[model samples]
Target chain A: MTEPSAKRGIAVEQAVVYGLLTALGLFAFVVALGYGLFLDEFRVGPGLVPAVVGGLITLIAGWELVATLRGQRTPHDKGLAEIVAAAAEAPPGGVSSDDDLPGGTLPSGEQAGEGTSDGVDIFGRTAAMRGRQLVIVFVALTVSVLLVPLLGFLGSFFLLSLFISAAVERRSWISATIVSFAAVAVIYLVFVVFLRVPLPAGLIGIGG
Target chain B: MLDNLVLGFSTALTPENLLWCFVGVLIGTVVGVLPGLGSTTGVAVLLPLTLSLEPVTGLIMLAGIYYGSQYGGTITSVLISTPGEASSVVTTLDGYQMARQGRAGAALAISAIGSFVAAIISLGLLVALAPPFARFALDFGPPEMLAVMILGLATIVSFAGDNRALGLLMALTGLLISTVGVEPGSGTSRFTFHSIYLLGGVPFVEVMIGLFAVGEVLYQIREGAAAPIRAGFRELLISKADLKRSAAPILRGSFLGFLFGILPGAGSTLASFMAYGIEKRVSKRGHEFGTGAIEGVAAPESANNAAANANFVPTLTLGIPGGATTAVLLGAFMINGIQPGPLLFDEQPALVWGLLASFFIGNVILLVLNLPLAPVFAQILRVPYGYMYPMILLTSLVGAYSISNSMYSVWVVLIFGIIGYFMKRLDLPMAPLVLGLVLGPLFEKALVQTSAIGDGNIGIVFTRPLALAVMALAIIQIVAPSLMARLLRRRNSSRARKADQAAEDKTEEHSHG
Candidate 1:
């Protein structure tokens, strides 16, 4: 593994990402091969598509990993940087656009250096801050999902919303509580009252 | 066609459908204005709510969001230099300049009008062509279908991002994910891993919500908040000269966008960019393009809306999605127990035509709403990300739970949300992966059928001329870009050499004199 530095961190990250994908692809291929015969009754069997897809993944991911190790930049690097820089410098008026376009991402290798730790991401958040925020949100989400079965959907999401607003977003506790309750109320109205969805009751039994 | 129109109107004009259509577009506009929440996320998060409605009504609303967001995306581009949708990115080049010059309202007005005109034009073409296209596709056998699927996958993978290999890898990964459930035809579970939840496979709708909605929310949170701009509505008026100047560009963009949109992988974003690029080349005001020319705003806005409408052609006729959002909508179709494709017209005439008809109504509603209210919608940007994102996360997870009334679906959303975030962080192209997930079972089914039809010889695909033609098209898709790049490089270098020689000749002449 390469040491983490501003200059080499992103490249190392890219390598790790592709390396993991390559490993996952191999695992899928091997597991798929273990799924039994590729053909049954002289017809296409269950493992056939999986085996093909898995093999393709391994080959492609391996190729990408090698290319990354060779310090080859993707063709999109220039386009993505220009676009992301444009998007970052401008005061963005909206949140997320659909990821269906060419300029949706930063380039993989060289461009990540430009959007490094001290740099701001496209939405203007510092890269370091983004990492922290992502971890907090992800942890909160995992906790919320686990709590859903215990605390029920409404109660757990109320706590989840509170955490996000107060902890992750750093709002006052009172504001966070209000936002959380309001959000949960809206959820209750839309899902439970209007749509008649059977949200879990758990111990709270609010929507049950 | 007239009978179909009548039936469509009868279905779409129902008060219930009209109301929901309005609601859908309204929400779509807000979604587009909000950033981070595009039509795909909007549709996926709200899809579970539509489960209780009649399929036609639900589909009408979903389709409305798909197109309505095209109209909504331009508001931010014109006012703030931030496009709410990727399709509107080109508009910002000139649109924000227009805003700086206090012509923001005029830009918004023309964009609204141009989008309306383009929508009508494209919808008319859709009504005339889709049925026949479906009829043509009806002749396709399993081999031809297989070829078409391959073409779709290849086209998307090749054009999706800078790295074709990465795009293809993501797609293959999607297909691998799709293989987790029961095997089609064999009735044997392949990767259930002894979990009851795995038996039905990774749930499609849940994954969509996770990827598009929750994942997007998380990604946006990390990006820091956008500073909202104040847009005044006092000048929300388009001059007659402005209309006249924009008319030709609007028409050109509509047709051009429709052509791009009809292709499986070429989505509205590219269409909008191409429209803007060509307009800059061909318009009389071409040089004034980035200086906030009215034609600049009109062309890309019209093109995006036109392409958004035209996307339905392939979706309805071939059951192939035109982009990621349409792919999600296609999943919505399956969720409602309706399979989309050629036979859709024959089997569900009312639903198909009614949905098409609603596009007209939705466009009309959008125009009316946007012309007077774009600035008002722009105000939505003021809502702090603090409040906005938490609500999005809650809705996404709750929506996931409502899908199956189980924690399993919620867990899937969480897992995929993380994957989606990482994929975004790594700059992976998501649409191909999404399209692959949507098309995987269909692709495999076609392959199996083709093999069976050919007595276990998949080579039968080559025997069929139509299938071979489709395969050739797929190969061309993969090969053409690199070939074109090489040609471009050679041409540029030769031109540079010629210029250098001319300069040298001039220097020698001057010295001799």
Candidate 2:
């Protein structure tokens, strides 16, 4: 019953992404054109390749946006399915739950959606929970990066670790503190003592 | 060849080189076992540290990480049905089943053996073929080189994702990003916007670390956590029967993986899947494939490892990356002031040969290490992600800053990390984008040279037979997949319509009766 809405939601998201990409492509195209796409015979300008590439990007991205609006499947949507469909058709032990297949594994031959993490499908979560966690993580990372110069690398990282472990993961303060310190110590030994990286030591001026 | 081998061993056998090699593989195993880290990120984040070492030593360690991750990925797959690397995805099919049936140790053992055998076989082929291929490539001029780069880009775009347009877009975007620095032919800065850091260009290693490390961490955090299965060391033994069944599949997978790996973008993941699919078709126990067939575990495991080794052929000889991880390795080459191409063989024979010999040594170390410690390695998964992810995040940011001791580099990592996160959510392939970025400078240089050679008529590509041949291949790569897919769709729909018509006819006759 909710399948159609879920699919529509994906389409809308894709439309937004493609729209932004189209804008970027157009901007690049215009900028490259301003730089003089072609110079003269026997020699091309610096902008020639960029102009062509930018124009192509604009066209393709715009076309993709339309296709998303039209609800059309991509030409290659079936590639991964074709490879693993035969195997997935049969159930090996009714392995359905995360607990059944450890390491948070997905079904057979599913494309590892992300390049890292190796094919674990972490979908089927409530949208609210996933969104909240993602937002929090992103915010935490931003704040940490902003704090790096001011608080110094190690000091800022220590607090970041504390926030993630204590605030995000909801661990006990003691455990979070322990984790944070351990992580900082390792970073110090590796980057500072061992490799001699000359990390920033902000106003506090420690662990440089 | 004999003298090259001697030089390789002598260089590789140094105490310092061997130590770094061990450190690399050991770290690689840990990186592979972790959820959000892979060899690409591992190499990138750790790359700055290696700059302190000798070039050959640094390269040997980095290559060790590449192949070591292949072995490490299987441990997770067999023990917990989780593939630590993309190429190991197929192993979970029969590998997990084996674990459920009290043969977890056997599954791990067989994978280690198969990977070792495949590495040996693929390395042999790489050693023999790469030099000759480089020698042949020396004859290529600007037009031919331009065609080759185009072919590389085309092949990657075709194979990277379901949407060819998306893949091409990402590649173009990478090329666009690569144009930020001053133009090679003319000293005009295209996209610097007047920043000092922008003059040098967006650092590729930092981008890689951001995309693969921090980006993956953010993505995985949303995934939360999962319970892992436990495998006891006492149960980790393989029977004689298991060995006999796996022998053929391992050999078949080795050759097949090597073939795929030599291509520009058909990576280890594809090779493993193909090997498993073919093994299923050919094996007499085909029906047992999904039900823990030993051959199933053996084939894919062997294929992924072989493919990992074979990826070096194109990377070392042609300067074109074999896959995403190798793209980062190519960046490492450039970071070390080394340019990889046909000239690399003659110019840096010691570094090249020494690096190759280390692969042989590294695999031997992996086999010996994995055989005794598969269960021990699986224990790493027990560490909570909460502790691990924070560390990874810190390392990525710090690593970026360490690259050139600039806050600008850190900012680039942070921005690209966000971009990578969004790309993952949208299912945009990262490999094509990375390959494009790595190839952009080389590609542009070729383009400019070709234009000069042909007096501004790029159409001269059609005149040279070698260039023409390569261009034809590029066109085929770009067009063939979609064409074949359309044909298949048509056939399927026609068959479906015929079946529907038969059903309607049967219903009409019944009503009349």
Model 1 error, position B497 (Å) = 9.2
User: What tens digits encode model 2's per-residue C-alpha lDDT throughout B249-322?
Assistant: 99999999998788876678878877887787688776577677899899989999999999888899889998
Q: Which ten residues in a row have the lowest lDDT in candidate 1 chain B?
A: B484-493
Model 2 lDDT on a 0 to 1 scale: 0.81
| Per-model chain A TM | 0.70, 0.76
**Candidate 1: residue A206 Cα off by (Å):** 3.8
Candidate 2 lDDT, A49-117, residue by residue in tens: 778877888898899888888888555543432334234323233223233443223532222332223
Model 2: fraction of the reference interface contacts it also forms: 0.33
Query: How would you class the docking of model 1?
Result: acceptable
Per-prediction backbone clash count: 6, 1
Kindly report which residue stretches of model 1 are placed more than 4 angstroms away from their true locations once superposed: A1-7, A36-42, A75-126, B232-234, B487-513
What fnat does each of the candidate structures reach?
0.37, 0.33
After superposing candidate 2, which stretches have Cα over 4 Å from the reference?
A1-9, A71-76, A80-127, B232-234, B483-513
